[model samples]
Target: MDFLRWTLIFLVLALVSAALGFGGFAADFAYIGKILFFIFLVLFIVGLIFGRGRGRTL
Candidate 1:
């Protein structure tokens, strides 16, 4: 959850920086955002696969 949030923040920052003409900062932020997104995606998939059998009792 936190990871996703940061990824979004970075992406937004990247866009804003690019609009402001801060090419270097924008590129760096974009790269970081992309990496974070991939990490979050992998974690989500892993959770789905491994965290699926521990809920509720009838």
Candidate 2:
């Protein structure tokens, strides 16, 4: 849920930046968006790993 919210916010920001013709700002926002995307991916993978591990009774 949090990831979805952040992703939406990032997309909005990217769109706004692009519309404003701020290439540097747009690039920065894009970089942030990429980072956030990776973070979300990592969180999802960790959750999956832990969830599966939980069922295995470590």
Candidate 3:
């Protein structure tokens, strides 16, 4: 969750920086955002696979 939020934040920052003509900063932010998003995706999938059937009590 936190990783996803930071990914989005960095993506937005990258877009804004690109719009403002800061090419180097934009590229760096975009790269970092992409890496974070992938990490989030992998973690989410792992959780889904390994964390099933534990939400209720008998």
Clash pairs (backbone) in predicted model 2: none
TM per prediction: 0.89, 0.74, 0.90
Lowest summed lDDT over 10 consecutive residues: which window, candidate 3? 49-58
Local accuracy of candidate 3 as per-residue lDDT tens digits, 1-58: 9999999999999999999999999999999999999999999999998889578668
- Candidate 1's C-alpha runs over 4 A off are 55-58
Q: Model 3: residues >4 Å from true position, as ranges?
A: 55-58
Rank candidates, lDDT, best first. Answer: 3, 1, 2
Q: Mind sharing the TM-score for model 1?
A: 0.89
**Candidate 2 structure quality by residue, lDDT tens digits, 1-51:** 587578768878888999989888888777887788888889999988888
Ranking by TM-score: 3, 1, 2
Against the hidden true structure, what lDDT does model 1 obtain? 0.97
Error of 2 at 43 (Å): 0.8
lDDT against true structure, model 3 = 0.97
**Cα RMSD for predicted model 3:** 1.6
Q: Which is the better candidate, 2 or 3, if ranked by TM-score?
A: 3
Alpha carbon lDDT at 48, candidate 3: 93
